[model samples]
Target: MTGRVRGALAAAAGALGFLTRVPVGRDGDAWAAFTAAPAAAVVPGYVVGALAAVVVAAPLAVASDLPVASVAFAYVLAVYALVGVNNLDGVADCGDAMVVHGDRDRRREVLADTTTGVGALAAVSLVVAGLALGAVAVAGTAPFVAVAVVLAAEVGARVGLAALAAFGSAPHDGLGSAITEGAGVGTAVLALALAGPAVAWPLLAAGSTLAGAASGAVAVAAAGAFAGALAGTAVVGAWATRRLGGPNGDVFGAATEVARVLGLHAGVLAWTLS
Candidate 1:
């Protein structure tokens, strides 16, 4: 392979390793190299993680006899398991930071603490429960539809992270800081562009199920969902930046988790309306 290709591959491996427990290489090189991976480079890692979730959930979803809660439980477990718990840790930190009454320094200190506070625990529980409930709702319609929506939603979450990295400024030196600097507007646009089709396909299938609506309606719904999710990401980035004094690892984590939930719900709502 060419140098660029090799570099990209290495970065992808690194991104995946950092994002999940999945073994990428024989050594720790990829994880070490992950620090330099750009926001765009990490997009593929998100795809891999999302695809893994789809694979795990698809079987459960397809089993018509399966309970909705079972499918949801299985799917959520697979997603967080594949992506690694650190992502949730970020969510917890951000939660603690959000509720804490102090300046950026105090918030940062709270975030840095390893102990999970009441606010952090509550935030994590809410997000995880929301994910499970949303999965059940989506899966109730059809397994295939649920799979597609989830696949898209996970991608949407990562896309939000990329957008944040591309557009938001990081206040301190850390994991998010490297990404913020390395990932440019071009990368953000590319991440969104790549994620659009992923979000659309599932919505297309769901929309087709509605009477009087055809593929065109699917197109409309998909477009709306994708647009809505991006808008949501922008809003999250803006709000988090203001509240947290710019994007951090915690902010990115919280944003991704939030986007995932929002994307799934928005897609389902669009389908319902159509």
Candidate 2:
């Protein structure tokens, strides 16, 4: 395949993995014989998420006889069915294990073992439902602002996952790191190179959403939440690298989900305040 075709193929596979339960193979080599551009491949996943939001949100905005608010909520309701819970699971696994109980060692163990704790269940279930409802409410009440809010959260989480994925292991390279390694430095540069300008318009629109918030409290809340979202992934990644000394595919998957859910809620709550 041509270079761009390879890239697009890689991106689409990663997106399929991101949005569904299917696994992203080592090196994302399912398509390529060897691992191919894992980190850069994540761009496709972000594209998919952004597309998913637009697909679900736009139609709901137009056709529903329900109040705009109700229509907004429906978008979130679809999200929970589509992509939200996956993140919630990651959050609960990270939370119940690391945030609530257990040291780094124990948390890693808990995270890996095929077992579920009450905390994990509660955390994921609650966050999924709450975020969906909150998103719905925000979309209904706030409309364009809420769109920016969720989009930022979605885009931020995916990008954050790619950045964190760069730190991986040897024989056990991270799902992100391994697949990323396939793409090469030049590919990564190209992937991110166009991102800034592409999102410029959205950023402007997002800025408009945050404009009225003009409050220190709202800023603090949003900032704090954004920090919190990163903590879950960074902490887990660090712990895996430091203690266990490497990140596994599960950890990578866990990080992606955790980051996405946390960003959504944090954005929603922050926007709600203003």
Candidate 3:
């Protein structure tokens, strides 16, 4: 393979290792490559989304009578199991920062504080509940539709992270800076391009499984969900930029969690309306 190809492969491996509990090996070289190629972050979304989709859909497929609630519970568990609670730490940190009535520096200090506050408790609770509720709605859909929605949401969440990395500047030297320092508009475009297949595959599946109108609705739902995820993350990024000076590792994590939940709801709502 060419040097570029090898570099891209290593970057992708690094992304998977850093982002998920998947057994990809990690190293200094891989981490450096991943930071340099921000687009590589989008690649892992497909793998993570697929695995999570299967976890959500497999039970329904095997036992058609399985309760939707049970499936939803599994979906939530599968997400945490795959991605771990590291990102959720961001949610807690950001949550604490959000409630602080102080200057940006004070909020930033709160972001770095290890002490758990009521804000953290509330934020984490809401996110977890939102995720579960969204999964319940998705689980109520047709199996193919459910799978498509789950996949789209997961992938969209990662796309949100890539967007922040590509477009936002870090306020300080940390994880956010490490990823965003080398990124720019080009990185954002490439990340979006990498995410296209995740969206397209769902539309194609919808077309195969439903009649024209229904398929079109699914198409809308999937697209809406993806867009919703990006939009949700954008809101978080903008808010963080204003409130905390710029995006940080905590902001990125919070964005991911928020985007996934919003995306899931947006897809379900679109499908319901259609």
Candidate 4:
């Protein structure tokens, strides 16, 4: 392969390693490549989303009579299994910082503090609950449609990360700076291009099993989910920039969690309305 292709591959591997519990791409070289390319952050979503989708969908396919609550629980489990609690920690940190009534430095200190405050407890609970509710809605859909929606939501979550990495400013040396410092608007556009195919995954997945109307609805749902994910990401980025001076690792993590939940609900709503 060409040098650029090899670099892209390494970056993708690095992103996968950093973003999920997968065992590959942890080496220093892979990480270097990953941090160098902002678009790399978008590639791993396919792997993660596909894996989570299968984990949730397989049981439902095998046992169609499974309770919706059980399916929702499985969905939540699959997400934590694939992505782990690191991002959730980010949600907690951001939550604590957000509720603190102080200047930027004080809030930044809160972000760095490891103490589990009431805000952290509340934020994590709301996120977990939101994810479960989204899964409950997904369970009500056709199997293929459910798979599409789940996949779309996961990919959208990653796309949100990429968007923040490209456009967000970082005030200190940390994970956010590692990405934001190396990325620019061009990289952000590339990230969006990489994410564009996710919108079609639903239609392609449903082509053989779903009717034309259903397939179209799935398409609308996927698009809406992707849009919603970006919107959620923007909200977090804007807030972090104003309150904490810029994006940080915790901000990125919070954005991912928020984006995924919003994307899931948005997809279901679109599908229902369509």
Where's the lowest-lDDT run of ten residues in candidate 2? Answer: 194-203
Q: Using Cα atoms with residue i matched to residue i, what is each candidate's TM-score against the true structure?
A: 0.83, 0.64, 0.95, 0.95
Q: Assess the local accuracy of residue 232 in candidate 3 as a C-alpha lDDT between 0 and 100.
A: 82
Arrange candidates, best TM-score first: 3, 4, 1, 2
**Model 3 RMSD in angstroms:** 1.7
Give the per-residue Cα lDDT of candidate 2 at 71: 57
- Clash pairs, model 3 backbone: none
Q: Write the per-residue lDDT of candidate 3 for residues 1-274, one digit (tens) a residue.
A: 9999999999998888888887783888888999998788777778877888888777877776889999999889988888899989999999999999999999999999999999999999999999999999988876666766777887888888888998798999999999999888898888888888777765665546552236666777777788878888999999998998889999998999999999999988888887
Clashes of each: 0, 10, 0, 0
Preferred candidate (lDDT higher): 1 or 3: 3
lDDT of each: 0.67, 0.52, 0.85, 0.85
> Candidate 3 regions off by >4 Å?
205-207, 210-213
Model 4 per-residue lDDT tens digits across residues 1-76: 9999999999999998888888989999998898899688787778877777776677777877888788888878
Q: Comparing candidate 2 with candidate 4, which one achieves the higher lDDT? A: 4
**Candidate 1: which stretches are off by over 4 Å?**
25-62, 200-232
Q: How far off is residue 29 in model 1, in Å?
A: 5.6
Ten-residue stretch with the least lDDT total in model 4: 204-213
